[model samples]
Target: MTPNAASPLPPPAERRRLRESGSLTQDQLAKRLGIPSRTVNAWESGRTTPRGRKRKSYAALLAELSRSAAKVTVSLEKRPAAPEPAPAAAPLTPAQTFDALYAFCAPALVRQAYLLCGQRELARESVERAFQLAWQRWPEVAVDRDPAGWVRASAYEYALSPWHRFRPSHRHPEPPPPDADDRALMDVLLKLPPPYRRTLLLYDGVGLDLPETAAETEASTPATAGRLLHARETIARRLPELADPSVLHRRLAELASVERLNAPRPPAVRTGGERRSRFWTRAAIAFTVALIGTTTFTLRTAPTHYEAPVPAGVQVQGVPPRVALGPLSEAETQLRTKLRQAAAHGPERLLPVFR
Candidate 1:
C-alpha cells in the first residue's frame, strides 16, 4: 500500500538507460543502495527484480535519473539548431546494419560459445563464422524475430559439432583452465551430451525461459526440461557447489568471463564472408562450365551407332578342322591361268577398276 511500491518502474532497457545516463556504474549504484551488483545485473538483464525496500530505492533512483535526462533532453532541443540545420541522417544500408548487429552480438556470443565448447579458439571462430553466415543471409536475418538468437544458435552448433573434434587443431587438447575449479567445472560441462549442455546454457546461463530454450533446441518442452534437469544433476553430482541454479548461473558467467576470447572486427568478418561467398560463387560457375564442357565432349566423342561386341570363337561340334591344302598340280595350275587370260571382255585393268 506504499506509493513507490505501487508504481511500476521502467522497463529493463530504460532502467539500464537511466542508470547509464545518471553516470552511475552498477557497482556504484549497488554500493549506494547496499545490494549486490549481480542483483543489479539481473534486474537490468530482465532476469529478476528487486523487492521490498530495495525495489523502492531502485525505483526512486531511476525516477531521479529519468527526470534529469528529461531536463537535459529539453535543454538540448531548445538550444541546438546550427546556423544551417544539418541534413537528416540516411537510413543504414544492409552492410552497415549487418555490421552493427555483428558488433553488438559477437562478443557475448563468443563467450557463450566458449561455455558451449571449451576450446577458446573454436569459441571465437564459431562466432565469427556465425556472423559471416548472418551477413551472407543478411536479408533473411535482418527480418528475423531474434537475430541474436539466430546467430547464437549457429555459433553454438558450430562449436559443439562432433566434426570439430576430428579437426587437426583439435586433435590435441588445448591448455586447461588456469583455475583447478574452473577446469573441473569445464570438464563436467563437456561431459554432458551436447543437447543437455546447450539446454543448460540456454536456460541457466542465457536466461531463456523453458519454452524458448525448447524451441531453440528444437525439442519438446518436456524433453528440454528433462535435459536441463539431467544436466544440472550431473554437474551437481560432480560439483556440489553448483547445485543451485543461481550459483550455477553466476559460476557459468564467471567461467566465460575468465576466458581470453575476442572476436574479429565486424568489417573483417563481413569481408571474409563476402570473400567466401565470391569463392563459392566462382567455384560454382567454374563447376558448371566444366560440367557443360564435359557433357559437350561426351556428346561429340560418343559413338553414334551401338557396335555389338564380337562373340567368343567356339568349335563346331559336328565338323572337324579342315586339313591344310597343298598347291594344285602343275597341269591344274596351268589350266586356271589360261582361263583367266581368256576371261570376259578384258583383263583386270579393263574391268573398270572396281575400287
Candidate 2:
C-alpha cells in the first residue's frame, strides 16, 4: 500500500471523515451501514465519533469498500426503510435501536461467542454479522419493546445461520475437523433454538440471575426460569458430554479467549495530500454510482418528494428521510405514556441517556 503524504496521525476532521465515510460517500455509506446520513455527516464534520465496537463497524465498512474496489461484482445499494423528515429522530429504525442495545451487551455477547466458537475471530464476526442482519431488518424486529433482548435473540440466530456453520474458506482453508471438542460444542450449541440458546448462555455462560436474564432477554421472570430449566435438561439429554455445566462453561470461555487474541486489525491510513486525494477518489466513485442509480430510479418513478422545494437550501438525494412526528395527536399521547411506562425500568435503564 502506498502511504499517503498526509500527517501520520490523521487530523481529527480527517479521521472523522474517514470513520463516517470510511466505506464511501457519507450518504451512500449511511445507507449501506444502516445509519442516518445526518449521523454520517455529523461524524464527518467532527461533531461526533463512533465509539467502542462501532469503531470496528466503521473498519468493517472500509474493509468492504476495499474489497468492492477490487471486485467487479460487488455493488452497494441503499436498503429501504419506513418513509417519513429531512433529519430522522432518535430511534430512526429498529436496526438502530438494536445497534445501540447490542453495543451495550457486547461484553456478554463476546464472552458467549468465545465459549461457543472457541476462537476470537469467529466470535467477533458472529456478533458483527448478527448486528448487520438486525440493522437490515430493524423494522420487523421486536426491539421496539426490548432492544437488548432482540440483540441477544438475533446473536443466537446469527450463530446458527447456515453460512456460519461452514467457515468461510478464505479465512479457514482447512477448517477444524468435526470431532474436535470445540466443534462438538458448536454443533451442540447450534442445535438449540434461538430462545433456548439465548437463555442458556445468559444464565450459564454470562452468569446472569433469572431476573437479570429475563430483563436482558425481554422474557417474563417465569418464562426465563422455565427456559433455563428446559435448556439445561435438553443439553444434558442431547449432548451427554456437556451434562457437566462446568465443562461447558470452561470450553466456551477457552474458545472466547482464543478468539480475543486473534481479532482482525482495522485498516491503515494515508497521509496529507495523499489522504485528501484518496478521500476524493473514494467519494467520486460513490458519487458516480449515486448519480446513476438516482437518475435511473427517478426517471423510472418520479419521487413524491422534491429535491429542493425551498430556496437557498442545499438538497442531497439517495438518503432516506427520517420518520416524521406531527403535532401529538390525542392517541399519540396515550401511546407515549404506555411506551414510557414499559421502558421505565428496562434496557433504557442500562443505557446512558436514561441513566
- TM-score of each model, in listed order: 0.70, 0.35
Using TM-score as the measure, the top candidate is 1
Model 1 spans > 4 angstroms off = 1-51, 54-86, 306-355
How many pairs collide in each candidate, listed in order?
0, 12
Q: Candidate 1 — worst ten consecutive residues by lDDT sum?
A: 346-355
Candidate 2 ranges with C-alpha deviation above 4 Å: 1-111, 114-122, 127-174, 177-180, 239-241, 258-261, 264-355
Worst 10 residues of 2 by lDDT: 263-272
lDDT of 2 at 288: 99
C-alpha lDDT of candidate 1 relative to the true structure = 0.88
* Predicted candidate 2 versus true structure: per-residue lDDT over 291-326, tens digit per residue: 999999989897776596557857798899898966
lDDT, candidate 1, 1-355, per-residue tens: 3335465788899999999998998868878888656578778888777777888888888889999999999988898466677789999999888888888888888899988888889999999889999998988999999999999999988998999877898888889889999999999998999999999998888777777899999999999989999999999999999998878988998999998788899899999999999999999999999999999999999999999999999977978778998889999999999978875763554654566
